[model samples]
Target: MHIVVCIKQVPDSAQIRVHPVTNTIMRQGVPAIVNPYDLFALEEALRLKDKFGGKVTMLCMGPPQAEDALKKCISFGADDAVLVTDRSFAGADTLATSYALAAAIRQIGKEQKVDIVFTGKQTIDGDTAQVGPGIAKRLGLQLLTYVSRIADLDLEKDTITVERRAEGGVQVLQTAVPCLITMLEGTNEMRFAPLENMIHAARYPVRKWNKEAAGIEDVTKIGLKGSPTVVSKVFGPTPRAEKALMQSVEDATPRDVSLNVIQKIFTQHPTLERDILAKASV
Candidate 1:
C-alpha cells in the first residue's frame, strides 16, 4: 500500500507579476509555495496512510529549491521525499514533464512497489489538468480524475472505490491497484505538522536525482527539445473601456424591474429573444 504523491512548487498567484516587455512571468520577487491543489492530494494520501499503515513518498520535479516543498510534505507525514532536477528538464511542457516523472516513478518502483499514485486535479500555474493523466497513460495505470472521495479499499483484493466529480453529479468508480488519481480540491484539509515531525523534516535528507539517476533513457524526450507546445506570448486580459450598467430597483416594483431589464436585453440583442423562445419550445 505504498503511495506516491506528486507536488510542485509554484509562485504565489496573488503576488505573481508579468513582465510587460517580455510578456513573461516575473518570478524574481515572487514567493514560491507548494501548489495549493496538490495539498488536497497529499492530505488524501496521508489519510490513507493513517488508515492502512503504509508509506507515503513525496515526489517533485523542479529546481533545487523544490526540495523545500518536499520537506514540507515530510513534515506532514510523508515517509520519504525525492527531488528530480536537471538542467535537461528545464522548460519542459506537460508531456515532457510526465515523461520525466514516469521515469522517476519507475526508478522509485524498483526500490519499493507503488500501489497508488496521487496528484492534484490541476496546478494553478499550468491549469491544464493534463500531467496526471499523461503520467498514467505513459505508465499504463488506471487514470481517475476529479476524485471527490475514497469510498473503500481492500488490500487483499487489490480493489479501490471512489466518487468522481462530473458535469452535474458524482460518479462512483471501482478500480484495481497500481492506479493514478487526480484529487479534487476541497475534499480534504492538510494536517498540521507536530513538533517532532517538524524537527525530523528539517533534518531529513531528501534524495536528489538528475535525469540519468531518474532512469530517463532518451535524451531527446526531455526538457525544451521534447516540448512541442510553444507559448507565443503571455499577457494580461485587456481592460474594457465601458463600465458595467447598473440598474436601480429602489423606485420600482420587482416585476416592473424584471420586465424593464428583459426589454432592455431584448432591444440590445434581438436574436437572444428568438434563441430563448426556440429553446423553450423544444
Candidate 2:
C-alpha cells in the first residue's frame, strides 16, 4: 500500500486579498497553509498506510516555499515527500498542472510502485475539479472523484471499493490498484501530529524536481505556453444595481406593514396586483 497524497500549498483564506489594480491574488505577505480539502485526502491516505503497513508519500507542485506543505504532510505521518517546482510551470492551468504531476509520479513510481494517488475534491483558488481527471487520463490510472467513504480495501486482490458522491446519491465503485482518488471534504478529520512525525517532518529532505528533472520533454506542454485557455482578466462579480427596499408599517404593526407594502406595490404598478391575484388562485 504505497499511497501517494497530492497536496497543495494555498494562501490562507483569512489573508486572501486580491489586488484591485492587477486583478490578481496578493500572495505576497500572505501566510500559506495546506489546502483545506487536501487535509482530508492526506488523512485518508495515512489511514490506509497504517492499515496496510506501507509507506505514504506526499507530492506537491508550487514554489520552493511549498516544501512547507509537504513537510506538514510528513508531520501527519507520510513517509516521503516530492516537490515539483519549475519556472516553466508558472501560470499552468489544470491541464498543464496534471501533466507535470503525473510525470513526477511516474518518476517516483520507478523506485516503488505507487498503489494509489489521493487528492482533494477541489482547490479553493481554482475550484475546478479537473486536475485529478487530467492526471488520471495522462497516467492511464482509474479516477475516482468525490469519494465520501471507503467501504473496503483489499490488499490481497489489489482492489479498492469506495462510496462516491454523485449528483443525486452515492455510487459504489470498485477499481484496481494504482488508481487516483479525490477525497470529499469533511469525510475525515486530520489527525494530530505526534512528536515522532513532527521531528521527522522538520528534518525530512524532500526531493525536488524541475520540469526536465520530472522527464517533461515537451516544453510546449509544460507551462502557460501549453495552456489552451487564457485568463484575460479576473474580477469580482458585478454588483447589483439596486437592493430591495423594505416597507415600514405606517400603523406600526405586522399586519399594517404587510398591508402597506401590498398597497405600495399596487399603487406603483396597478397591473402587478392583477397578475398576483391571478397566480394566487393556483
Candidate 3:
C-alpha cells in the first residue's frame, strides 16, 4: 500500500502580519510551520503505514523553504518526501492547487502505485475545505472528508472503512482503495520522532520538482492566472468601543449578589422583567 499525504507550509498565525498599504498578508520575516491540521493527516497515514508495512509519501506545494516541512514529516516516519515548487504555482487558489497536486500524484503513480491519499480538513490560511474534494474529483478517486477515525483497511480487497463526522452523529463509511481522505483535527496526536530518524530527516535529500517535473502541462491552469477568486482586501474585525461590564461579588453574599444582578437586569430591560413574570405564571 502506498499512501500519499499532501501538506502545506503556512505562516505562523500568531506571527503573521498584514501589509498596511496592500492589505495583504506579509509572509516576510514571519516564521513558517506545517499547517496544524495536516499534521493529523500525516500522523494517521503514518499509523496506517506502521500497521500495513507500506511506504508513506509526503507531498507539498509551496516555495523552496517548504522542504523543511517535508523533512519534518520524514522524521515522523514518512518513507519519501516530494516538494513541488515553482514560480508558476504562485498565488494559486484551491482549484489550481488541486490541479497541480493531482498532476504530481499522477507523476508519482508512475513510480509507485498509490492506494490512498490523505489531506487535512482545512488549512489555517485558506480554510475553504475545497482542495481535498477537488483533488479527488480531478483524479477520479473516492472522496471522504472530516474523517474522525479509520476503522479498517482490507489490503487484499482494496477497501477501507472510516468513521466520518456528520451534523448529528458519526457516519461509518466503506470505500474502495485509491480514495482521498481529509482527516479531522483532534482525531489523532502526532507521534514523536526518534533520534535516528531525526538525524536521517535532517540529512535526507528531499526531491524537488518544478512545474514541468510535477507533470503540469497546461500553463493556463496554474499560478495566479488559473485562480478565479480575487482578494480585494484583508483586514481584522474592528474592535467594539464599549467593553463588557463585569460584576464583582467578592465581598457580597451570593443571595445579595444575585438580587443585585436581577435588579440591574430589570433596570436595563423593563420588558424582560415583564416577560419573565408572564412566563413564570405558566
The RMSD of every model to the true structure, in order and in angstroms, is 4.7, 3.8, 4.0
Model 2 TM: 0.86
Q: Which ten contiguous residues of candidate 2 have the minimum total lDDT?
A: 243-252
Per-residue alpha-carbon lDDT of model 3 for 1-282, expressed as tens digits?
899999999888988878776667777898889999999999999999889888999999999999999999999899999999999999999989999999999999999999999999999988889999999999999999999999999999999999999999999999999899999999999999999999999999999999999999898999899899887776766657998656667878888889988999999999999999999999
lDDT of 1 by residue, 71-188 (tens): 9999999999999999999999999999999999999999999999999999998899999999999999999999999999999999999999999999999999889999999999
| Model 2 residue pairs with clashes | none
How do the predictions measure up, each by TM-score?
Answer: 0.85, 0.86, 0.86
* lDDT measured at residue 158 in model 2 versus the true structure, 0 to 100: 85
Off by over 4 Å in 2: 19-24, 242-282
lDDT assessment of candidate 1: 0.95
CA lDDT of each candidate?
Answer: 0.95, 0.89, 0.94
The candidates, ranked best first by lDDT, are 1, 3, 2
lDDT leader: 1
Steric clashes per prediction: 0, 0, 0
Question: Per-residue error at 206 for model 3, in Å?
Answer: 0.8
* TM-score of model number 3: 0.86
Candidate 3 residue pairs in backbone clash: none
Query: How well is each residue in 1-282 modelled by candidate 2, as lDDT tens digits?
Result: 688889889888788888777767787888989989999999999888778799988899999999999999999888899999999999899988998999999988988998999999998868898888898999999999999998898988988899999999999999998799999999999999999889999999999999877889788987898798899876877657897766666537989888878888899999998899899998
Off by more than 4 A, model 3: 17-29, 239-268, 271-282
